[model samples]
Target chain A: MFDVSRVQKELTECNRDKAISGVSIALYEGGSDLSHLRGTITGPVSTPYEGGTFLIDIQLPSGYPFEPPKMQFITKVWHPNISSQNGAICLDILKDQWSPALTLKTALVSLQALLSAPEPDDPQDAVVAKQYLQEYPTFVATARYWTEAFARTSVAIEEKVRRLVEMGFPEDLVKSTLDSVNGDENLALEKLCSS
Target chain B: MAPVPASVARQAELLKQDGNTYFKKERLGAAIDAYTEAITLCPDVAVYWTNRALCYMRRKEWNKVEEDCKKALQLDSHSVKAHYMLGHALLERQDYAGGIKELEKALDLGRGANPASYMVEDIWQVLAKAKYLEWEDLSSKHIYRMHKLMEACERALTSFYTIEDSQVQNDCEEIASERLQQLEFLKDVFGKAEQDDQPKEVPDYLCCQITLDIFRDPVITPSGITYERAVILDHLRKVGKFDPVTREPLEQHQLVPNLAIKEAVQAFLDKHGWAYKMS
Candidate 1:
């Protein structure tokens, strides 16, 4: 029922257009019958993320044509517009710049471009972006550290949370709190404190 | 009379409990299942879908997140959780412009309508998360309220300006000029562009594009170029690359930022001298 054909077509185009380095696409279907759409875009060549592969998870709406699909980074990377813990990107195209004309290809390309030229002035990852522009070397090292630590792997947040539940936390409190934080452990703990 | 299937309601309750637990634990995968089961048993319950959307968002499972949020909103548009979830979903999907609209809606009904009120600090923290200050400056307040207040103030000022006969109609510049000057002075101490913390003034050329009747689409500029689309079109026409008479390009006109203002600029190519089309 879902039109994965568009995603396939875009992947082919992206692979052919080799300028975009290590980006790859995957579809995670059914662990709750949740047809999770996932993709990875490798950092551009010669940047801090040169060898690093960044993960992006996409969620298409039922009304795909009329409403915009949602996307966020799965693997953590240090970037101006992406959150360090959850990889929540704060790009305008996904927010305000969307038009019917834009395709997944363009969005991916824009993301690649974003990494190449991080807009530190308006950053989702304010601390990271701050370090990026203000202390280029430190930012580069930190990015490399994150890529080595977080990206280049597929660690599920739920997988960890499930493990934590087994340890001791009351299941209801854990899931609700974790779900509230969107499955990022750091954010989950943060939410836990206040909740 | 048929015997009551006590397990059905019990199962639904368990699922709701599991969903709630999974939600807190940050195990969205399990939470989604729990919520889905609850929805299957009781489709009419608004909180089921609302909770499910939050799980979907946790997994970055966008489509489902959106559907659940929409369903929750459908059940009750006034649901702040639905509005907040929808905003996050849209924001994740790079529909920031739409997300902001949704966030503004959530913010407007005050804290009661939204689930994000639980994580109020994060909401404010994330507002300043985006790079563009004007895009969503949570530092000030909800943008919609600001717009509404600005509109009311502008209306009052417009009447005053009409009486005074100042040339600039609804001059926000005239209204905030002194405040802006003070802010500019503060920028020197604060180190304006260097820190990227302060709200920089939106440039005049950019402001002009916003004022233009045709440029009303709620899109942030793709390229942060100084030249507006109209200005670019006008420049292309002046170069004769795009014939003003026919209003069509001789060839596909491609423009980029920061080269000479003119690229492959064609000017005064005499049609009479040898440029006529061959019959």
Candidate 2:
């Protein structure tokens, strides 16, 4: 019952502005299953989350585009509105305020906005909120450190291919395997070894 | 010009036979090699290119299949296999409307040749799929066009049943039936999509959350969530036994027809019938 064509259209529209909007969506594992997706959103500039690339896990329910997409942060980030423990977000647009007119791109843009302006009053992580309100400088430092430590270490494609090739697999196989696993070196190596 | 040597032609024939053997054995890679050799010996022969295209199709290398099929068609414009292969490749590449045109040509050409050589049912099914996929995006805006397309699919199904080939007929029955059901569903959905053009705004509560349409036979879930009866029932049947909006555990029996809201929607529709075009 999921509107696959609508999701496909949203992906095209979102990715067209990836360089400008800093949000991109791709099918999980390059498979045609539209139910599960991997989305990447570059952190907003001039914010604690800047220079970090956040990955979001997007699941389209059967009533998608009608029912709001179920999205959760896959990357660890320290923010008042986002849970450090599980990456659950306390955002209004993602909840009861979601409208049918909004797209995945708009949702991601809202998240980027949320990254820039953290609301301490309605917080997913109470500890983070308390720190944000009581010790503003410490909260900024912690958030920046968390972004640097967790979100900035995405594996480069060339580096992954090189590592896999060094492990005695053919370059073509390494490249293809890396692509299939979305550039995960360990998974690519496992696939290569299995093959 | 001098006549071609008999030995060279015989060598090409021998290679072609070898390719046929490999093709029959399902050794597509070996078959392609043999067909390539046959083409190298006699590039003028369209059959060799068509045979190689068949091997590429088996390998699921659609680009290569399209290229070879194109080459075969250039050599012999009337080759049914080349047209069919090219059409299939085009369809796989998501050129549905273009593929349908090519397939129609293939079917027309096939009819004049050997009846047994043609898989008419398969062609019809692919044609149905191509037609359906082509019209899918437009169905919401053009209900009349969708109705016409459904009629065309019905005609194709009828014509397919007229074919005497039992083997192909049986092979295609499931696909044909499924396509018919799909077209019917689209027709129903798009029929409602016509209401989208309505200028008047119904009250917020009258609209079904699942359909976004003003309620027709509105039903209230046990959780107090109201939905169009058919829409909620369909969601419950196909998706899950949970409220689409509330996600509360629900059952069909838990749904009670909300007569008050239904009357309200009816009164609104009656006053502003032009808005809904209440069919």
Fnat: each model in turn: 0.00, 0.00
- Please, what is the whole-model Cα lDDT of each candidate in the order they appear? 0.58, 0.77
lDDT of 1 by residue, A79-165 (tens): 888898787888887875453335565677778888888888888987888887889998888888876666533345567577657
**Cα lDDT of model 2 by residue, A1-66, tens digit:** 776645766787689879999999998757788899988899899999889989888888887765
Error of 2 at A108 (Å): 0.9
Cα deviation of B266, candidate 1, in Å: 38
Candidate 2 regions off by >4 Å?
A: A155-195, B1-279
Shift in Å, residue A192, candidate 1: 29
Model 1 chain B: weakest 10-residue lDDT segment is B268-277
**Tens-digit lDDT string for candidate 2 (B1-279):** 354578987998899899899999998888889889888878888999998998998889999999999999998998888888899999999887778878877855664243346554355456555654554444444656666766786677556655734645455677768767866775677557565534445566876755455564577888888876655666677656777666778898888868788678757754543334221
Docking class of 2: incorrect
